[model samples]
Target: MKFLLVFTLVSFIISFLSDRNKTFAGTKKGLKMFLGLLPTILNVLILVSVFLYLVPKETLIKILGHNSGWLGITIAAILGSISLIPMFITYPLAAILLKSGVSYRVLSVFITTLLMVGIITLPLETKYFGIRASILRNILSFIGALIIGLVIGIFL
Candidate 1:
């Protein structure tokens, strides 16, 4: 993480030196985008925190543990599809789930579907890509996520 921060800083400095106006404009735009997404990010984080607090670890293990099998995978996929978490939060949350005894297969499917399919963003996607295309993409992604999870289960 430190290396990434240093690398990004160096890249930004170089870009600024090469084209000050454009670099500043780009930075401003990026900041604006981040701010725009901040509220949604915070809401997801708060909900996740509350959920983790309210739900016991034993319950989570029962649902997502190694023995959970197909049931766990289905639950994870459904949750991932409906969630609107940021990528940054998803990874850390995955780590927490793993530590709480979630199976790798389940985590794989959860992460894949969370990243690939976005039911919460369906309206926006439909507006941009048309309802048919958006739904088709989501369906394909869901299938792909299942395949990926199965492969991971077999290998890991």
Candidate 2:
């Protein structure tokens, strides 16, 4: 976390020093991006709280707490691929998943799928990258995620 803080500080200072001509615009863009993410962040927090309340911790931990094996990995990947979650909020969801005892291998595959292929973004991706190319990319990503999950399981 310290690295993140230092990185942010350095970026701010660098942007401030070099972009003196359009500092206001830069700050405005930064603020707008932050503001744009607020709604998603709030929603994630609410969801996390609700999930923790509704689901028993021990049951969750037992199901996901590292012993569920291949079933958990498959489920995580499928759900992750179908879910239309933004990158910014995935980490917190990840934390919750981890706490619930989900294996790191499953988490890895799930996260990989979440970023590389989104069901909600399929149309956009197809439009931007062509249908065949998008399909190929998603297929390859799915396979790669599965392989990586197994690798993580083996090593971990």
Candidate 3:
């Protein structure tokens, strides 16, 4: 907020001092764009906080572990992928899980698959790329996320 205040002050001064009207107009446009996006940015942060509060840290950690074998991993990934919860929510949730003994690898899979394979966004994706393309991309990405998680698990 302080940084934004400083930026606003700087912009105001620049706009006021500038002789060229074009420069002032350009600055105003930039400021308007920033202001327009601020609400979405703040909303995302608030949702993250809320999700972190609502979900139990232990359960998140359990989901992070793949001790349940491939079936468990598949189930967890499928659920996570189906979840339309925003990334802002997922990251802090992952942080809590990580702090509570969850494996980073599983969390990575959850997050990667969560973002990459979106059942909720399927309508939009399908509209853009037909049903087959969307399904193929999602399947390929899901498998890729699984493999990456396993490889990271071995090292971590």
Candidate 4:
């Protein structure tokens, strides 16, 4: 994280020094991008908070924790595939689940599927990539995530 911050800072500094006008335009574009994503970010934050608050810790543990086994991984993967969560919020929420007794395997599957398999974004994906391609890509990604999760579970 520190490396990223430093790299970004240095890049921004170089960009500003080399071309002030371009730098300013880039900053404006970046701000617009942030604004565009703000609502989704806020929604994810609220959704995560509400979910954690409404669902009892014991219930969460019983469903997704170490004792929950492959069923828990399947549940998490399905939820991840269906949900439209920003990566920033999803990771922290995953970490919270980890702390709450969710197994590494479950978290691994959830996080991987959350990133790769976009069931919720199928409409947009299909519009861009064609329905067949989009569906195949999602299916492949889901399979890949499961394999990756299994490897991570074995190694870590």
lDDT of 1 by residue, 50-82 (tens): 887898888888888888888999988998888
Off by over 4 Å in 4: 99-101, 120-136
Give a tens-digit lDDT track for model 3, residues 27-122: 788889868866776787687668657867666545445464565466658877898875545676677656666676667777778877888898
Q: What's model 2's lDDT at 26?
A: 82
For model 4, residues 1-156, the per-residue Cα lDDT tens digits are: 799899989999999999999999998998998899778777866887798889888888888877888889899889888987777567767776787777888889988998999987899999999999999999999999998987887786
Selected candidate, larger TM-score, 1 vs 4:
4
The alpha-carbon lDDT assigned to residue 93 of candidate 1 equals 73
Question: Which residue pairs in model 4 clash with each other?
Answer: none
Cα lDDT for residue 130, model 2?
A: 98
Task: Name the candidate that leads on TM-score.
Answer: 2
| Range of the 10 consecutive residues with the lowest summed lDDT in candidate 2 | 59-68
Q: In model 3, which residue pairs have backbone atoms overlapping below 3 Å? A: none
Q: RMSD for each model, in Å, please?
A: 3.4, 2.3, 6.4, 3.0
In angstroms, give how far residue 2 of model 1 lies from its true place: 2.6
True lDDT of residue 71, candidate 4: 88
Estimated TM-score for each candidate: 0.70, 0.83, 0.58, 0.73
lDDT of each: 0.87, 0.81, 0.74, 0.86
Global local distance difference test of model 2 = 0.81
Question: Considering summed lDDT, which 10 consecutive residues are worst modelled in model 1?
Answer: 88-97
